[model samples]
Target: MYKRALPPAHYSLKIQSFSLLSKSNVDKYDSGVFEVGGYKWSLSLYPNGDKDNNGSGFVSFYLSIEETDKLPHGWEVDVNYKLFVYDKIRDVYLTIQDADGAVRSFHDLKTQWGFVDA
Candidate 1:
């Protein structure tokens, strides 16, 4: 994974799972857990709310990694990860490509959402 600048803010992101099966194949997925590169990152997916489909299912997700830092201010970090989805047609994991088809840096993902002095 490589770090790419996004205007001014950036985050560490990479393929955490491949061919993930959630069981519930609703038209959309709203909530679920994501395992990224061996680490479990909580995800909040809002594919459709009650207003749309009686409050159920989702198509996409907004990923947020739990993290904490101590270097003061927003410090840059090293990120190496790959993100992918299961390709049912090929029976294999298909790599999700970004606009440039490269690992994206959404923010400093090296830190955890824990006490800094702990």
Candidate 2:
């Protein structure tokens, strides 16, 4: 079991306008693509949670692979990711992640993974 004392990599996302990300306004919002371990990835935000998953009255976030068309069929990637939300009142980042160092698989069929209860 690989226990990450801290994330091997991290990305900070800033949302300038909260209202613009609401589910009623937009289905989802995607952060610009980034590279981790040489794989293209992005952060997807569902401000109103994922409707299909009963993610309402809460924020939903996901990590997804990009440029899948460039990858070979059946190719998959395993990754460990953490999501953070900044608390203005607390002046700290609230972090949520896999406690046991679980690896999430991203493949052709399922290219994204995340917490809907966030």
Per-prediction TM-score, please? 0.35, 0.82
lDDT of 1 by residue, 1-118 (tens): 4444532332333333323433434333423445444334554433233234344442344444544243336754333333354555678975433445443344465432211110
Tens digits of per-residue lDDT for model 2 on 9-104? Answer: 777789875765572578688898998777898998888888889998788888989999998878988787788788665689888787775898
Global lDDT of each candidate: 0.39, 0.83
Q: After superposition, which runs of candidate 2 have C-alpha atoms over 4 Å from their true positions?
A: 3-7, 19-24
TM-score, candidate number 1? 0.35
- In terms of lDDT, model 1 sits at 0.39
**lDDT score, candidate 1, position 91:** 82
